[model samples]
Target: MHLNRALQVTAAASSLLLVSGCGLFSDSTASTAGFNPPNIKMQSELGPAEGQVNLIAWAGYVEDGSNDPKVDWVTPFEKETGCQVKAKVAASSDEMVKLMKTGAYDAVSASGDASLRLIAGGEVAPVNTDLIPNYEDVFFGLKKQSWNSVNGKMYGVPHGRGANLLMYNTKEVSPAPLSWSAVFDDASKYKGHVTAYDSPIYIADAALYLRETRPGLHIQNPYALDQQQFDAAVDLLKAQRANVGEYWSDYLKEISAFKSGDTVIGTTWQVIANLAESEGAKVKAVLPQEGATGWSDTWMLSAKAKHPNCAYKWMNWIISPKVNAEVAEYFGEAPSNIKSCDETSDPAFCDTFHATDENYWKDVAFWTTPIEQCLDGRTDVKCVPYAKWVQAWTEIKG
Candidate 1:
């Protein structure tokens, strides 16, 4: 949604700004255009929960017994808070942003890609974590990040996190590959058997690879890339295309490919690896020496929510130890609530997901929209914004 609309803006607005002698590439006018969030005060006191609360979230984040009778969290939440829950499952970050813009939902489980857009567009309001008791137990590393905060004001509660790791069939890949170079530089060794995630966000993986391999590029941050650095990363992917078997977005498709021996190596999430292994595929996933790209989602309040009290209750309830563990175990990510580690069904689930290891994540770069104002704080040169990344991704696919 943002990519399609942004391309149109690039075509139309770039020329207008150019004619006015404005710095076209130095500013972002995509999803954030004409949006200035009002300085609204957060609710300081809890009140009676409303009768109902509407939510928009990723497919697995909110369960109401429709998908699987056993995977029900909403029923218990409703019984506790007296707030009936109704949720709409969003397919993408763009869809989440569009839904939030309607001002119909009380809250949303937003990924990094959509969180900042929602924040900048004034679709979501600042969250007062002091009011949520569970906020005190959330992983310290997940709090007050750039994607969920502005000027030190928190906008959401952490939901979960997972890394995009380098996965390979252990039997086929020799000597146990430890770097992303296996996919970028050495992919040709497994030519036509290598896979990659199908999204513009994959560009960051290439940038991450380049950051470690090509020091001359001076790529301080994968998401914050200037024209030259962006071009280099794009060129690398173009070259990598020659060896790619197929690009994937669906986990099932990837699992099938790995099982059928159609793919031997590529990028993947831990859940995919687990599923593939359960299916008897000898696959091993690694964070790689260069680290990895990852995602941490947040539950954000809508700016025009009609059930604010219920929304707050739901946010706190969702991140409480037991509920957070239930969601994390079911959704295949590390729970944001530290105490949730003890509540998981599988005794080793938290350790397997690296739930409490802050040191393990230092090298893992989380996803954030690439703004023109470089995230690394460089103002001397304009960086390639997310709109260009979207356009470039289309070309890379071609």
Candidate 2:
């Protein structure tokens, strides 16, 4: 999860594994045709729900009412399906991957970062959407995406969607900036007051900015960067490091920074912007002219799930109209279920988040794991992988 609350999925997810000999430097392009996930048979039919189901997820994705009295979705789900929900909150995608590998949990709310890893590692199974009756109500854009499906076979159900927007304190940033240049190329102007996400996945955000300004680079997909493009992005981040006051992974830290006037501008999500504003900080978030990095989370079932029937039932229940709206509104992201738009407590909630606006999301590039084989279809040279991105990120912060 990028935000403290929750966050993303992909089919091209499995495609990255096709690239062989992944290392510091390699010369090969990943081919989707060669990427064959373990031939695990898909569940053909539904069954009786188990007594309970265990879930590994981000903090706010599964609410049993312990956090806030008003935020109890799991309880109702339990009563309705007679399947008790036992959820464990994972602090990071890396942690989620480790947990999922243990096969202790029935389902997971996996983001794009971990979804592919799960698929390639044969940790999660292909979903039988026919068993999930509510799947038909899910938005068209959320279905069969590169993150949630592999070669047209669905692996998970879309939960929600959101973008990492450029957030700036109105008082510190004059004229209300509309482009990402305010934070990338011209970040020095706000030296010692700039911030960015504290994750290797953020490399794609840098790549996204370059996609427009550095046209000669021919960077098509931010996630699929060849050696040259990846280097350029790393270089840009290294330069920006001089102006970074902090690289934040926690929402509270970012909100506090903006409220204290210690940080003026950087990347953020809609929930952070809302929180900062509620605290009386004059902040505004925008999708920069160059588009922005986004997420589309999915509810995936573990291949070795102890409660397969319960997992399927839970997936269907979570995405149902009313429950989907409740979760989307509380978590502060666009609902993947179109019917959820009308079920929101606030009639205009969908409009605010562009919940049903397909065109608004056209420019938002959802997050995905970067592998040795360039995701952009370049074969002559290899692109940096996630491990390399982590090393580069550490170097940039230093």
Candidate 3:
């Protein structure tokens, strides 16, 4: 559940991919045969409300006024569409994929890592953007990408985006660090006070660092790793593990650790850093010069959804400007809808998250599934897939 907030799915999202699994990286429809999506056709026309829509999502995504009475957006949705929202909070992307496979859920707010698996496994269907009136207002950067689409066909509406940042205690750390090396190369300096994200996807952070530090590896993209590149990243993590006081997945535990001074420096998200600071921890977060790993979540429709129309309505309603702003602010991520910037409670919120800055995002490597083919345009060798990454993460943790 803690990972749900920082959300590291087991996917390998790369920043510079122009094509992925028979699909263009973004907006380009061309696909290769090895990466064909399922044969399911998108719904041509939307129909009446089905009265009930079952949803599986990361925590805080489907808030129904239960957690904080003022934080709910679900009640208004139900009244407007006559759709009874039956929401289940999924602990991780893996769980989200498993729940959608059951055919009980109508939709899911899938992160990039899970979205690709759902599309490839045929658990979700291609979305007809025409049926969603609000689709036009969505940020172009969030659409037709490797994670949420196949062969240029979109499978879901983008939910939001956020980056994994480097956090350090201002007083304990001598100087503000500008690169990932603060955790990898100089981890011993911090001794048993460094922290890192606990998930397979975090392997990309190591790979990302090596891509800049070890150009001899010729690592073009962090997610697309040949055997040699993958080994190097794994080795780096194994070494860093010695200095890591703990690997965090839950937000509460991390906040507690930071506030207690048990973790002086480590990987973190903006939300966690904010909470820790509010709790009197002298912490500051930075994106670092090497950029960072991030996630872009999507609202995917289940292929076996029992209430398709209502699910469609929910997707559109959630991404509407006001709603998108609410979700983005409460969830502490950039909104997928461009107009949402204007609706946020704090006018500077959009700038703070770099919500509308395309150039700023070029450095953020969004999470996506790594496949047999290299994501960095290397045709000479096959890149290690996500399964290998999972195995390596377990070994590194052990």
How do the predictions measure up, each by TM-score?
0.89, 0.90, 0.91
State residue 190's C-alpha deviation in candidate 1, in Å. Answer: 1.7
Listed per model in order, the count of residue pairs whose N, CA or C atoms clash below 3 Å is: 0, 10, 5
The collision pairs in model 1 are none
What digit string (tens of lDDT, one per residue) describes model 2 on residues 306-395? 899999999999999899999999989998887776577776677779775566687898887776666666777777778888898889
Error of 1 at 307 (Å): 1.5
| Candidate 2 ranges beyond 4 A from true positions | 1-33
C-alpha-based local distance difference test score of model 1: 0.85
The reply for model 3, stretches above 4 Å from the true place, is 1-34
lDDT of 3 by residue, 299-331 (tens): 999999889999999999999999999999998
Residue clash pairs of candidate 3: 12-368, 13-367, 13-368, 22-31, 22-32
By lDDT, the better pick of 2 and 3 is 3
Question: Tens-digit lDDT track for model 1 on 249-362?
Answer: 889999999999999999999989999999999899999999999999999999899999999999999999999999999989998986776577676687788876666766
lDDT for each of the candidates? Answer: 0.85, 0.84, 0.85
What TM-score does model 3 achieve against the real structure? 0.91
After superposition, the stretches of candidate 1 with alpha carbons farther than 4 Å from their true spots are: 1-40
